[model samples]
Target chain A: MSSKEVFRPTCIIGLGLIGGSLLRDVAARGATVYGFNRSTSGVRAAIKEGFDVSDDLVATLQRAAADEALIVIAVPMHAVGDILDAIKEHAPNCGFTDVVSVKAEVLRLVKDRGLEAHYVGSHPMAGTADSGWNHSHTGLFKQAAWAIAFDYAVENEDPGKFWIEVFTDVTKLIQLAGAEAIPVEVANHDAAVARVSHLPHVLAEALAVVGDNGGILAQSLAASSFKDGTRVAGTSPALVRQMCETNSAALVDVLDEALILLADARDNLAADPADISYLADAGYRARTRLNARSGAHKNSVSPVKISSRPVLRLKPGAYGWVSTLKQAESLGGRIEVY
Target chain B: MSSKEVFRPTCIIGLGLIGGSLLRDVAARGATVYGFNRSTSGVRAAIKEGFDVSDDLVATLQRAAADEALIVIAVPMHAVGDILDAIKEHAPNCGFTDVVSVKAEVLRLVKDRGLEAHYVGSHPMAGTADSGWNHSHTGLFKQAAWAIAFDYAVENEDPGKFWIEVFTDVTKLIQLAGAEAIPVEVANHDAAVARVSHLPHVLAEALAVVGDNGGILAQSLAASSFKDGTRVAGTSPALVRQMCETNSAALVDVLDEALILLADARDNLAADPADISYLADAGYRARTRLNARSGAHKNSVSPVKISSRPVLRLKPGAYGWVSTLKQAESLGGRIEVY
Candidate 1:
């Protein structure tokens, strides 16, 4: 429990994209990484890829517990509880964390199983439309935000140096995996991610339905706009279902809000179609602001800069240079149009 | 009009992205191009970029009419009637077509103005989220589908050689602009593009609204998925409003259907919150099918290839190699492992 408490060999259950990625990264960091997956193919895939993995879950847990290891359940949200139960039974003394989309529910379940003090919750905001071990890469977590949900049980437990070091080591491990560790309350994390992540999945799914109904003509005419707007629709159905089901409360709420906004725009178009730029303007401004802000604060976790400096090359008497300068000023960017 | 009718200079009114890109491409094909825009700055920008552009709409139309040139109205949908009226008044004998998203209304307006024989309808399914002349490029329409709505008036007037040659010339011009000329009925064009184009815009705008509501936290967590899912949200609001407003009938219908699909998914999630893969699987299959179809027939306008061949390389004793081969076969591809 000292400040010098070393990170033990890690046990990662469920060797999907996130699990496989974590195993590859953690093992490369000089920490022994043991992996387990229920599906025989998942284990074989990892083993074939030159990793140490096993299909026997209980044995992996017992071995991990003997080393006081950090057991990470990298399964779907619904599958996390069963893994926790197995960990409690076979790896009773092991500290644990999880890489699930829904943080509040997992944290609550950990508390229900009386394992809160030994558990932390993390969610990486990094993924692709593809899933599984083959799609997983060691660099998946690089430059991504790994959200660490502040567990209530840990706050309520004895405030000792050991607990502090344990939590700090977990954060260090997350950083070692090539992501920024962001501390957030579980409720806030779920709600915020619902807006950014889950809501888009729902909308993309619905968009795909419309495209499917339109048949050949729709497919032929679908361009960059439609393709990008529904890129997530091509993802694995089980993963999409798991994410929505586990984060149902926040997701449904956000979906309802989004529908209301869309309905309002639709009704406005229905009423007076000519000047519907109000909604469009609002959307353009908001999206661009987010993009500019994202560009401005890409490396640092701090708030976005009030001003940015971007270099631009302008020819002699460049048309629209004045407007471009004005726009840069409005966005709080200094443009040196030479 | 003989079969040897040469393509005369094209006078394009509304020098935006589509118009500017067309102007650059058409002029590069050795056909003279005259551009006109209502805004003085737009004309100035085009002229500065070494194109013949003027702010005087009447002068451009008169000159084009004298050459019996084809005038392309490349403005927003709502602005089409005004331009049509101007063309009819100033360039009465000029052959005309429009590049509006909604075809039926524009065609009806052409008939209303008694210029049916002089007008054709087209909607090029190519655009970027960024609009205006600044973002326009010569290759915007390259490999894109340029849907030419078959005009009913021309069909009713006469199935003569001259009319056929005129239509052929227009199609050749569209090809010269680096796009495939797809002849479709106006009604069919409207309905199909509604599902593929307009519906995605509405959904993207709504997702952007939700992001705007979530503020900084949502913006920070917005990753590649959310970014791609809402890329269209940053497009010009005026354009989105116009497309939705002018094509309200089809857009509203598709929007309603999308909402129903989304609501069903939401209700199912709320009801069980355990398994909603039915909807997800359907969406995944549809999207993948579209992607594979897109890849298969990417070069032809014909219905997408029912099967495809994709090359793959596998190492010896690769785990799941058999399954990978099976998947390739199912997807109409052959695999070779060396």
Candidate 2:
């Protein structure tokens, strides 16, 4: 640990998949992590697995107050506001942040509560289909982007530095998993996610409706493509419902646009077979470009820093001769060969 | 080997991903395999790997005829017609089958040429994003559903029974990998694939257009949701185009239905938030069911089969524990309590 590395007693409220995962990653990085959850069994499981957890909100807040650690409200979006209110009553002096999918509304709530300076809105674009602490792992955040939203209060009061440092620490853990940090505006981030994330959920659900309508036959014949398309449909209904309600406008915009595209393609296909070919070709080109870019980005990012090492190559058609020469080279030492 | 296991010289034409994979799986079960390909390198590579491979189609066909083996056509959909014509002219005596995505058109072409009882249509609903022989593996068909489509002519001649046995042999190899065999009408199979397979490609490509219009920033922000939604887009453009073109009616019908569903959802989201929740919940339920079903299926299938030796569990937890225990129990060994 560096001398300048700031230590904050971190309180992760809700020991679910994201919360528990953050707790594990932060604790492993030498942070004092205190987890709070409603589920007694969940808390017990976390403790048994060697995590610093608690069930008492009062005591958790007191400890955070005493240590002056940041409180990360890592709960469902609907419960976040209430949790923040509870935390405010108990630990007013503590710094606050959240790990939620939708950010604009949460930021609005923080501002309305007059906790603007104390709170920084954050959303880590990382997760899996599974839920609960049992499914949480320490490496979940590695290589994922953690978006942090700031306001005038943070920048003017020099609180931005503290928030940045906290986010940097969080990003460091993410970097370990080969993820990158992307700074985006709360509205922009929400809009982006609405198009790419929430809209897919809608489409998947809509597609599922077709499958449901098709009866048992469609269900049995549902292959990998259908499975992949509807994977997001497996997410918590409550969570998805909350997201749709919270980010209704942006999702509507994206969904409307998608419908327009789909309707156009459908019309074109109905008019001419060649039109369908154009749509398919367009999709193929887009997918190819996305994959190529994804590959290039992955190659560019080194998972770990590598120390300088000597490189050696063998000439083609010289397997035996190269092996004999490499043997002699190894006897002399201080040389690397491939 | 069972006495009932039949031996026949099999010639696999166009040794690409599916062809090459089938060749390897069949050979492992003690069958004489002859491979023919346009690419000399592909033939050379197969021969080098100790398989009987030849670049000359006529020579391979003559050898297969001399041995009275079945010939399997594994090539692109558009090329199948020409290949069939060539096969009728060159290897008229040999029994024939195809592993094509669209079977109706191919079946029609075969019937038009009066090659009754000479060929059967098969579609193995399994593939990866990759193509060609280099990506081929013996386990490719394991547990995957292979659809065998027999027309009236073949069925009346009792050729369906013969083809079914050959398919059963292929299915056995796949069953070794933990796959299933499904029989359906060629038209129905094409229709089902149009919904499950072709529709996804169109949807993915449509989604990709969103990324393209928004530029690099849009694509970079595309996380797993976009990746999953667009995974089919990564498939070969030429192949997807052919699928869309060849199976136009079914693909158009599915796409039209999908578009209507999407449009309805979009309108509901814009006008009625309450209805959006219903859509979202429906999706959640469908996805949950799929995930549970897939997980259960994966749990029941064992990795490898051995006659005498006990199979060891690969991992201690939820992933591999069951298979290990089942293998051990099957070997007549009792698990000791520690």
Candidate 3:
């Protein structure tokens, strides 16, 4: 570790899929990481996978506090409150982040609980439908964009402050784990993910029910589109509920927007036979943009590599770091530090 | 070829992805097949890939007319009208079916044009975001479910008739291409695919617009769920429009249902922050059923492979063949002669 670097000794709480994968990636990179799982079976599985893990949360948190480790709460959104409380009691001074899908609720809860000092919110845009320790593996986060969120209070403060330093340390840790760390504001993270992530879960659920309503015949007729649209419906309902329920405000906003679009499509289709042109054309244009920007149209995710990553100069604005990270993301870059 | 089999000499029109792949698969299986492409470039590409293809649609139809070929119309819905007109002038006696996504509209068009004698509707539930002869491959239809639709009057007609023979030939050809052929009523096919296929296109287009509206940060944060949910948005806009516009009636029905579900989810979340359990749990159960029955949970499309397909007895229902084929599909079986 460098003399001034604060990016070592990762302490991951809730060693399920994301946490176990983090442990694997960090340990494989020869970085120090200790993980804790509430389930003894999860700990045993992590150990069997040759990862350092414990079932004792409080003790691990104390060790994390002593080592000044970067703590990652890699649990579902609903489970985060308990983990946050445990951290507050045992590892109050540790630099911490989370991999929850929703950011605003967790940020609010952290602030309300007075544990926001050493906190920088995060949500790694990774994972499969499967969960648990055994399903986790190294390289799960490779090339994935991890959203590192800042509180609104961090805008005017000097970027050299301890909190900003903690965030930079978090970004360094995220990059080390093989993910592209995109900086964002807490409010933006929640709203953006509400569209990209949370709404998908909701839509997949509705699609699943609709297909099932078509019964075995429809299931037999189901092809790539149906399969892809409902793939996320296979996720555990508990996690899905937490994702939708916790980000309820942003989710409701996107949900209303989606409903409007769907309703317009339905009404237009009813009135005119070929009026789906509006929906289809706009969607086609949007997909073309996405394909051009992200190379997501490829069979694999292949964002163009920029050899020289231009450093972001935080512009004078309300939450400049959010746009800074977004700019870097558009250029296919990640942050090591602010 | 077996003496009892009337299946041979396949004539495919439209050398796009599905048509080109069919040409590759059927020819590789040692079936006598000739493909017709309206585009000279497509024909050139197919010939370059070592397949028999011609840009002369009418002459190809004339040759197919002489050979008593099983004609397959592999074009989009709008294009099918001109092709059907050409066939009426060139090879009206040939046994024929279509691979259009929407079945009822084409069926009605065929009937209205007095070309319904040997016509059936078939949709091979396969394809990628790509198109054209160059993007085609041999194994595109491997393990896919091809929905074969029947006329309602066929329930009372003897299964040994010439039309039934033509239908059986189509199924045999589908199986030869390594796809399961499920027979369906024309009306039922439209409704079922509205839920399983068409609605997904509509939904995916809406999702693409929604995500793009979230701007670049949301795109950066997009993961597998978002990717999967909006995948069909990358399809050709004309194809998407045709699929939606041709099936407007059924699409509207399913779209309304999907809208209601989204609205309910939003209202429920607004009312009780944690009440998404209904939507999530229902979706979870539906996906569970799909996974269990189809083994769709596997990385590959695996329906439990049945070693012996039970012969479907024509039940005394309103449409026996439809139910019979659906029953066979539920057991991972395909109709060889029903």
Candidate 4:
């Protein structure tokens, strides 16, 4: 291995929102980043914007191989296999990873093709409802979670901690992009995402259908409440469908449970409308707990530990009590009045 | 009929969010708005806030009757019938109305007790997640819809249109409070609300459930996308459940329809996971439609309509053409070169 920092040359395949954003981030961090896009105009625009880009996949891959680069397949989920094939044919020695949301099938494909030695499965959970390169921003990955999958075997060998070193470096880079690296089994990741990500998409789309029967009038009267409620519904129906299909069993299970909960509430309400109070109490308690727990971790300021002793208790009418209490509290001390 | 303008001392039952807001709006507009509360502390707080309030319902009703005023019941759905019965006993001659979301059942109750001649059903489709009198704002109802229900018998007998006159006046006050008068059948109103209002509550609760399951790690990684997606889920569950219970059948219908749509999408995706393009396309289309249609209402700022006229066609190698075109477009015209 040469000491010239083999990670310097990086290739990003695709120039859509996610791909474009990653390219910009990598380039901004002093990496020589090259981009490949099927769209001639996209390639032209990226080049004009000072990126090393090419519309020709073969030419782009040849240049990447010459540089001994790492390649990131940032295409849509369905296009992942084709991109991998292209990488194998053109730049076979390059280390490869992807930023696809779904993993089980894709990881299986990589392993079966004897490409497991260089491939890692990654899912960077960051996006807006917006799409396209035009909507891309370098700050998109800020404070996001990037799940990176690493396997112990490489060509039926231990690889002697080489995979760990690569993953650690990748994790550090992800952290610099303001994302945390979470390691989990591909199946577990899919199930977890099916619950939080895919299920909401399906539910949101389903809720949006209410407007379909009511016509545009119903949708027009929809305030921020309805918009926020069905925001995920406005997500790409195709993507939502893909997510549901990819993680069908787990998504179906979650959906079934949600439906049961809703149905039970409806039945109880029919029996006695006031019984809706119980559902509301349950929801309130759940939301309050979520908010409190989330808030506890949200202090951006670094935590500091201090040891202190309470010296006195002041009565309401005690002289100099207000000033003393304020001073003590300001120093992060707990105060109680007797 | 008396020629002297009589000050109608209004009794607002249940001094909570809506009732308190109405009291503030009416009082500020020079109407004598008297509030009643079951909680003595609530009554005391209202009085402390300079409101004419009482813990005694009978006293408040008597005060309104003495001034030949209207009684506005502003309690939760379950409490409306009892409050109306109390008002009938103490202030039978005074006109009455209510500010409850669901109305058909309550309207039936009012008519069954022969109080329909004095009572009208009103549902103001406006509120915040926060409750209590302290959260009341006089401008809360501005630009919202207030549905007013009228009876044909009273208008046909006297032909004086007294109820209509009072309702029109109240509607004007509602308009002043920043709401529009939407005359609707109580059943139709409930159905419409089920689609637009009640359904959102169910969706919010569902989102809260997703957040709950995601736990601390998931919540920590939850960004603006998650926040926006679940914003409505943070609304008071009790109020939401009240809405759901009161309009259970309609909500259940909507929920069922929503689930079916979701199921269909899920199945479609399961059949073809490779077609994620459709999902992205649907999302793009929905977002585009939302953006285009958002400000098309009367209350919102009118969107700038782009003209299709190619007044001046741009020629190649035209220096400063882009800037000139931008300026021309900003001034509501197009620029092109022949």
lDDT of each residue in A54-149, candidate 2, tens digit only? 899888888888877778888898788888788788888777778888889898888778877677676776787678989998878664555555
Between prediction 2 and prediction 4, the one with superior lDDT is 2
Q: For residues A247-309, could you state the per-residue lDDT of candidate 1 as single tens digits?
A: 888888898888777677666756744345667887788788777876655665676332223
Index of the highest-lDDT prediction: 3
| lDDT of candidate 3 over A270-319, digit per residue (tens) | 98544788899998898888777765335443565432323454432336
Clashing pairs in 3: none
Model 3, CA-based lDDT: 0.81
* Model 3 docking category: medium
lDDT for model 2, please.
Answer: 0.67
Lowest lDDT 10-mer window, candidate 4 chain A? A304-313
Q: Ignoring the other chain, what TM-score does chain B have in each prediction?
A: 0.83, 0.80, 0.89, 0.79
Instruction: Provide the DockQ value for model 1.
Output: 0.32
Candidate 3 structure, TM-score to reference: 0.90
Candidate DockQ scores, in order: 0.32, 0.24, 0.64, 0.20
Interface RMSD score of candidate 4: 8.1
Q: Once superposed on the true structure, which residue ranges of model 4 sit more than 4 Å away at CA?
A: A1-9, A27-32, A44-52, A151-161, A269-281, A297-338, B1-11, B23-34, B40-56, B66-71, B150-160, B210-230, B262-293, B297-338
Reference-based lDDT, residue B176, model 4: 48
If the candidates were sorted by their lDDT against the true structure, best first, what order would they fall in? 3, 1, 2, 4
